[model samples]
Structures are given as structure tokens and as C-alpha cells.
Target: MANITAADVNKLRQVTGAGMMDCKKALVEAEGDFDKAIEILRKKGQKVAANRADRDSAEGAVIAAVNADKTSGVIISLNCETDFVAKNESFVKLATDLATLALNYETKDDFLAASFNGLTVADKLTEQTGVIGEKIEIGSYEKLDGPFVGAYIHAGNRIATLVSLSANVDGAEEAAKNVAMQAAAMAPLALNEEGVDSAVVEKEIEIAKDQLRQEGKPEAMLDNIAKGKLGRFFKDNTLVNQDYIKDSKLSVSEYVKSVDSNLTVTGFRRVALA
Candidate 1:
């Protein structure tokens, strides 16, 4: 058997971010062969990932990143099994780095296939699963781009949002960010009434009719009353029509118009830890 030194164990730990004991065990198992030790550690990660495949990864950080031009942005969540692992500085940094990398890709599958530190992002998540002993994975990936884009990450890293504006007008940054904040806080279902799902609209109308019938309203009035209720639903659930969180006296559309009458929210994406 080859002798394993503390230096060998520390080197493996540095390379793999594995715990000292894990690195030492891996080194010993590989009989002091550094390359073999790394392979062993990776196999351990794969095994751990398989074992935890069914575990819930509900806790971690939500992060957002925009390109230098601010015309595109991505929001992602790096999820783990517990809040303890979620709160680690390194874990949060990993999430932030992933979000930055994600800006180059349009979809989660492409981002996972992209390389990071000589490993694919998916492989990195598997490796982290072994190192952290949790089901580490990317829970969400959302991307948006337009004439101007802005992003917001709420405190505790639990929520993140991205907003796109119709034009990169003056004060566009502040307006976009405020809209992004509104998205993170209000959780709008769609950008506008037209963007809402048709099935959802029908369901709301049916629900409104039911509620009005329960209130003893006449059957002939159901259609008109339901139409009014549907309008209220749009005002409450759609992004542009919803009341601005910063200034409830102004609707989100009115507030953005206040910024620039020609500027409007083009798109938005929101993701939260789940």
C-alpha cells in the first residue's frame, strides 16, 4: 500500500472541495494516487446523487444576472435539501456564478450542458451533492431579453425577478428594477390581460358566476356581473394592471407611464425557492 500524507489529503480537498476526512479517505482508498483519488471522489458524488435523486431540494439561493449591455437577463435557483446548506456563503456564491453563466444560454438544458471549472454544470451539481451531502440541483431557470432588461434578487435569496422594457429610455433602469421588484413581491400571473391564459380566464369567469349566484343575484345579471369580475381579476393578477407595490395609488402601468409614456414592460420572469 502506498503511504498517504496529510499534504496529499489537503491537495485532494482543495481540488474537490470535499471535507478533510472525505479527501483523506479517498486518498487512502486510491493508495495515494492523486488522479485516482479524484476519480474516486467523483464516483462518490455520482453515487450520492443517485441515492438522493428522490429527495426534495426546496431550499437554496435564487439569483439573477444580466449581461453587460443589460439587454438580457437570467434568474436561477440553486436548491439543496435544507436551509443549513442553503445559507452557506460558498453555496450562495455558486448560485451567483451559475446565474452569471446562465446568461449565455436561453434554456436550462443548455446551461446545464455548458462547461464550468472543467465540468458541465450538471456534473458540478452532482459533485456538490456529494460534498454537501444534500440533493443539490438547479430548481429553476428563467430568461428574458428586450430593448432593456433589469433584474432583482430579494433578501435571503429566496426570490428573483427579471423585467424587460419596450425601449431603453432614460430612467429605464430604475423603472425596470421597480417593475422587477413588483414582480418579486406581487407574483403577477402574466404581463397583461392578453398574455393571460385563455383557460384561466374561463375558469375565473365561471368562478365569478358561481360566487354571484351564491349571493342571490338574478341569472340574467350573471353574464354582466361576471364580466365585471373578470376585469377585476385581470387588474389583480396581471402585471401591468396590478396596483404598483411601491405606490398603491398608482397602477403598475400608470407608474411606468410616469417614468416614460413610451416605455412599457415587455416581459418579465420570476422564480422563487420551492
Candidate 2:
């Protein structure tokens, strides 16, 4: 067996950002061969990654980036095991870098496969997990494109929203940003009643009817009452039909019309760390 020196272990730790004991063990297991020691550390990282694969990583930041023209944007959620690690500067920086990468990569798989410095993002994440002593992952990712795309990151970076508009007008970008904020706050399920899942609509209607029946409402009035209740649900849960949070007097659709009559929300994406 080759002798493993303290100097060799320290050097390996510096190069790999792995724990001291981990570096020492790798050096001992590699027979003090430097290159083999590095490989051992990488494999150790992979092992850690595999061990923590099932761990919940709900604490992290939602980040976003937009193009110069404000016509394209990307949003991403970087998840960690604890809030302390989530607030770490290094973790937040990694989230920002990933959000930037999401601008070019359309899917989470692509973002994970993206290159970071000298290694792929997945490998880098594995290395980070070993160093940070926790599980970490990309919880969600999305790219949006339209005539006007606005991105918003809510308090503590916990929620991210992207709003895409159908028209590019004088105030379209500003309106879209407000809509993004609305999404972050209201958690709308879809763009409008048309976008909501039909099954969900039916379920909501049935729930409404059941509640009315429990109240001893006449069966003859069930359909009309349930339809009214369904309308209320859509107005509360759909993006355009929702009352504008900033100006409750106007619906979101009305707010957009006030901004630019031709401008409308084409689509939106929202992601939260939880």
C-alpha cells in the first residue's frame, strides 16, 4: 500500500472542494495516486448524489432572466434541503447562472445537461451536493417567448412568473410585468375559462351543487345555481377573469385593455420553491 500524506489530501481537497475526510479516504483508497484520487472523489460525489436522490429539496430560490428586447424570458427554481443553504451566496449565485442558462435551454433536461465551467451541470450539481452536504436540484424550468414577455421574481426568490403578451405596444411590457406579479400572488390555474381543464370545471361544478343541495336548495334551481357558482370559480381562479389585485376595481382582462386595447396575455408560467 502506498503512503497517503497530509499534503496530498489537502491538495485534493482544494482541487475538488470535497470534505477533508473524504479527500483523505479517496487518497488512501487510490493508493496515493493523484489522478486516481481525483476520480475517487468524483465517484464519491456521485455516490452522495445517488444516496440523496429521494430526499426532499423544497427550500431554494426561484430565479428569472429576460432578453434585452423583453420578448423572451426564462424562469427556474433551484432547490436545496434547508433554508440556510438556500440563502447561501454560492447557492443563490448558482440559481442565477442556471436561470441565465434556461434562457437558451428550453427544458430541465437540457439545463441539467448544459456545460458549467469544466463539467456538465449535473456533474457540477453532484460536486456541489458533496461540498454542501445536502441534496440539491432544479425543481422547475421554463422558457417563454412572445411579442412582449415580462418576468417577475417574488419575495425571497420563492416564486417566479413569466407573462407573455400577444401585442407589443407602448405599455405592453409594463402591463405584462404587472400580470406576472399577479400570477405570483394569485396563483391562477389558467389563462381563462377556456384554458382551465374541463374535468376540473366539472369537479368544481359538482362540488358547488353538492354544497347547495346540503343547504336544502330546491333541485329545480340546481343547474342555474351551479352555473353561477362555476362562473364565480372561474372569475377567481382564471388569469384574465380574476380581479386585478393591484386595482381591485378592474378585472385582469380589463386592466390589460386599459393598458393597450390590442394587448392581451398570450400565456404565462409560474413556479414556486414549495
Please write out the lDDT profile of model 2 over residues 1-274, one tens digit for every residue. 8888889889988788778998898888988998898777777778888999999998998898988888899888888899999988878988998788778777789778989867788888887887787888888878889988998999788998999998888888789889999999999999999999999999998999999999999999999999999999999999999999999999999999998877788899999876
Estimate the Cα RMSD of every predicted model relative to the unseen true structure: 1.2, 2.9
What is the number of backbone collisions in each predicted candidate, taken in the order shown? Answer: 0, 0
Write down the lDDT of every candidate, Cα atoms only: 0.93, 0.88
For residue 211, what is the lDDT in candidate 1?
98
TM-score of each: 0.96, 0.87
Q: After superposing candidate 2, which stretches have Cα over 4 Å from the reference? A: 1-40
Q: List the residue pairs that clash in candidate 1.
A: none
- Please provide, for model 1 over 1-274, each residue's C-alpha lDDT reduced to its tens digit, 9 standing for 90 to 100: 8888888888888889999999999988888889888888888999999999999998999999999999999989999999999999999999999999999998889999999988999999998889989999998888898999999999999999999999988999999999999999999999999999999999999999999999999999999999999999999999999999999999998999999988788899999885
